[model samples]
Target: MIQSDTIHGIYGTEAAAPPKSQPMHLSMLPCDLKRHWGRCGITANFLATSTEIPSPAAASIISTVINEILENSVKYSAIDTKPIDVELSIRNNTVECEVKNWARLEDATIIDSYFKIIHDKDIEDLYFLQLEKTATDSNNASQIGLLGVMHDYPVTLGCRIQTTADPITPFQISVKAKIYLNEVTP
Candidate 1:
């Protein structure tokens, strides 16, 4: 059986400070992963309208980050039995986005590596360059997608992954990212 604790953590707490500006909420069937992309676009629009900073660059980065994380959930998560959950919130000038899904224990290691690469500032650029050089390599496409997001949003890209496993249990992967609008574009 799959544990539900991880899901609870992702959606559990209410924000300490509600967004001074309007909040946007979106949810859809994970059957069409394209809806995830659409949600990202909506997030970008929210960021652009709410923040004082010019949003062209920030919007692009935000959209890419959301899509990359959502795409991972859609691709690696168990189908039918488990649907991906994504939530986005902007509060106190920071945007927090999380995506969670069910998986096997072994998959947690892969999720760890993804976070390590995404959070490493020095290596992220090099990693992206390598990915670009090998863009035609199908096997590495997913890694490239992640690298692209890290490269574009290096300053405000903070990511975390949590997992738990036990006998006869399904593992869970939850990815969270926070982007500080003031720090990124100011």
Candidate 2:
């Protein structure tokens, strides 16, 4: 599970000095997005071995993040129509996870608008605001996934949109999340 190796360079052990420089990658699909939750387990295990998420507590946090992202992917993707892509990798002490799925054009636009707010102010501030709203009205829990990642973990969230060639339903969205492996708060 821990896929790492030591490689020496002419500079003498420089290339093999630190584990942070060697990143592991894992790509899995939610074969049946509507019924499958294994993708989240796969992601959590991969993160546990590939990154510094060794503690049970740390693993649980990463699992929560992965679960939310994969859930969003499954929720937006056409049921049983396409495989939800989950990619996890680590590089320079930073762990990156990306969830990609095809979504209705209008849904993609709305998701994009939400991601856009992350850039306007401190995400922690926005997260707390959302938390307050959720406390007052349960419906506000709808947007807790990404905001929970920002507030509870040291992660930055981003989104990328690619319109498909098909004019009818043309949006494929990729949501990217990054967390520093050694910087986990708890």
Candidate 3:
């Protein structure tokens, strides 16, 4: 488990410090969620015991969301020998998970379409409908896992895909998500 104090110290020395008034959390990328569930379980227990929050649901949601985000990074973004970067933080009753990869942007159209479809209607209904469509459609290659996250979790989810220009590599993609806990329920 990464502590808030350590995160504060690391970001403090940088040129521009991140906002520090909010509660935050952090974790390093694990080998795999199955292999590290034990660690997550312990972390959840500690957080539940230490915080004023009564429910352990937030911790469970964080673990699952991070696992899915990391899995996506490993499967989609780790293409050119670049290590996946995962960061978790909380601010103003919200939890943010960000994953960065050193891969060129691919199929931006498909990603845009996915977002469009997801945004057009209620997330829960859209997610279930998409799952059914994916199961029935033979031509669909897009992963349904993301929709699953939206369906299973009540938190408002946002995704951003960013591109950067580097002299040598030319491009890199960053995927970020912020899950608000205040609206999520156990």
Candidate 4:
């Protein structure tokens, strides 16, 4: 079982508790991540308008991050009634994008394994390995999404799985990707 402490660490120190002044601002985009909804193309459109990320490269990175997470959410989600949640916010000069969705109980373990790659491996090695796999016609193409975000973009990635109150989907998967504004080209 994935521990709460591990999840907390993935979200960074600030996310451990809410700020005393104001809550973390979350703006939900119009796009539905549960369905393909036109792949990255459509998601990028909404993501572009969601925040003034300033850097064009940063905007592209944010869009790609969202696209990858949304794809995973839709592919893994067990319940369609529960809408996939996408939140974009700016905190302490960093742009944070979070995507939440429900996954089957049995499939929840995948989150832990994915994060293992994040904590254990070097991003560059993983990226090249994934590229090599793709070149070899490997069936596990979906695994590269997170790796691409970590290797190609200047962002930090995190994920966690928790039990929700909903009986239909008692487990929820939340993935977060954060990029510093200063890292992006203005």
In terms of TM-score, which candidate is strongest?
4
lDDT of 1 by residue, 1-186 (tens): 223442322234435777655544444445565434575456445544544434666666666677677777666665434566766767776777777776665565566555554455466566766776787566644466655555566434433344445443256677666666665663
Reference-based lDDT, residue 48, model 2: 57
The TM-score values for the models, in the order shown, are 0.63, 0.72, 0.61, 0.79
Instruction: Give the C-alpha miss distance for residue 132 in model 4, angstroms.
Output: 1.5
Q: lDDT: which candidate is best?
A: 4
lDDT of 2: 0.64
Q: Mind giving the per-residue lDDT tens digits that candidate 2 earns over 6-79? A: 11111121233334445444444445545566756666666656556646666666677777777777666743
Off by over 4 Å in 3: 1-54, 78-80, 107-109, 137-142, 166-170
- Clash count, one per candidate: 0, 0, 0, 0
- Which candidate, 3 or 4, has the higher TM-score? 4
Rank all candidate structures by their lDDT, best first, as comma-separated numbers. 4, 2, 1, 3
lDDT of 3 by residue, 1-186 (tens): 211111111122323335334433544344443356465445434433443342577767766666565555555543434455655555656555666554443533344456557656777788777677878888545476566777777544444444445444333434455556776687
Quote the lDDT for 27 in model 4: 31
User: Per-residue lDDT of 1-186 in model 4, one digit per residue for the tens?
Assistant: 755334722565455433223323333332344344575457655764566567677677677777787777777777666667777666665677688877766667777677886678787888898788887885864578878877877778888778877777768888887776687665
TM-score of 2: 0.72
Clashing pairs in 3: none
